[model samples]
Target: MCVLGYCAGRYRCPNCGRSYKNKVNLGRHMRWECNKSPAYFCHACDYKTCRKDHLKVHLISNRHLKNVAGKIRYPCLHCGKSYTMKNNLRRHQRVECGKEKSLVCYVCDRRYYYKQELDTHVKLKHNISAKIEGFPVPMHWKF
Candidate 1:
């Protein structure tokens, strides 16, 4: 099968048969985003993924956030639901987490991750420069 446009060939992905132009990219894909046969294993738990970055994500999200209850408690800010991984929490918050964001943009009511993000949005979308409180002023203030 053809992946995107590349035909299945010697450089095709082993998991999905998505062909690539060279081995370096294939190696990178296998090490980071293969849908199957993930070699990197998380010893902190049974979590395994194809990419090494995922392993680190799992550690920071699942292991580091784990508490006295021995449960990964990265809760979705929108809902009370807890997650083992922060990425999962982020996904849930963005999609099906069933929660409302507190930081709503005054211009268009768009939600954001942080208050400063909302300020930036107001400035860009509304053409109103709402400076962040206690924000470090940029140098080159010519008076």
Candidate 2:
């Protein structure tokens, strides 16, 4: 048979005398007529993969996959707190590092390491109305 305007070349069935131009069609006939398994196998990791693209994806993903088989250990530098991932440690450092003491507030002239603390300072000290997520906070209230 012709596929995409190209002849697939003549292929003969080993079990029968039928001749087909397409190798895939011949293989389909063999699967229905004689029942044969595909012989392709992955060389690396000895994993049974159906296609070459699947094997490539497996090899690429295996490099970045975390090794969870062993015990996980991560130590925080600022306050001796430990975590599982370096990202969590970085996030903790951003909030509680205390090395950089000055923090500018967008809503007011006050500065704080924590935004909520700055919001409290703006409300109590400056007597300004501050709204957080649609909730209004009075200047005299401490929250």
Candidate 3:
């Protein structure tokens, strides 16, 4: 009932109801460390950490960015490759998935899985701008 005052066994913090083995640590935890107000806030989301470096790492990491973006981005139909950016997706297709390069462009020697990609290539390479229908990446994409 009275942990703020010294008990029979160990040092206890009444405010948080935590027991410390030593009295010095109890004083320190109550003053600075134990569940203090967040000093660092994440810009991308509502995640907050006690340290500034943690926030920096969370912002720069790929998994955190994807989670913040709600994982809504391009996914390769063939190799099931996922990308948060369109350019990254394009790069993955051109360089990574060599086997899925089946969709060929008659005008130039290029291959892609989706017609939209081929259309984009045609517009950029052959100067033929065609408004092709967008292909939605599957929401149930596996990791």
Candidate 4:
């Protein structure tokens, strides 16, 4: 059989047959990720990942310890709500746990708990810039 110039899927895992672009990636996959039991797991839930950063992100994004009593590592000073992650606790204090919904969407008149949420809403739903213009609007604002 005549081989092609550059055979794609040439590098495949021996265990799972998952293809990679290069041998280095394939070797790394086999050594660390491929067919391996997830080394990182959430303490609050069954969520698991192969990487530490992924586990950190999962812990930060989800309210895993909200209802789990005694596991709260970070507690809110104002409302006494608990969180598994410190960053989550900080976010709860800043935007949630009785904070007012100050940032409003000018287009749809929708309310948001945080500035980031409002910014995302405006950018995605309205497809408009979330930046607040200065009192004297700049020339670049013409767009």
Tens-digit lDDT track of model 4 for 38-138: 98988877888788877765654435544345454675656656667788988787767786676566666787776677768878997877565652323
TM match of model 3 to true structure = 0.29
- The digit string of per-residue lDDT tens for model 1 on 1-143 reads 55543564547776776667888887887766776677788665678777777766675564545733387578654445777677887877775565456566644768765667766777778777755577443342111
Which scores better on lDDT, 1 or 4? 4
Q: Which is the winner by lDDT between candidate 2 and candidate 3?
A: 3
What is the alpha-carbon RMSD of candidate 2 to the true structure?
Answer: 16.1
All candidates' lDDT scores?
Answer: 0.64, 0.55, 0.69, 0.66
Model 3 RMSD, rounded to 1 decimal: 12.2
In angstroms, the error of model 1 at 66 is 4.2
Model with the higher TM-score, candidate 1 or 4: 4
Quote model 4's TM-score. 0.35
Highest lDDT scorer? 3
Expressed as tens digits, the lDDT of each residue in 4-96 for candidate 2 is 423446777767656677778777666654444433445444554444555545443423122322435354544666566778768768766
Each candidate structure's TM-score, on Cα atoms with residue i matched to residue i, is 0.26, 0.25, 0.29, 0.35
Q: Score residue 59 of candidate 3 by CA lDDT.
A: 65
Worst 10 residues of 3 by lDDT: 134-143
The runs of at least 3 residues in candidate 4 whose Cα sits more than 4 Å from the true structure, single-residue gaps closed, are 1-81, 131-143
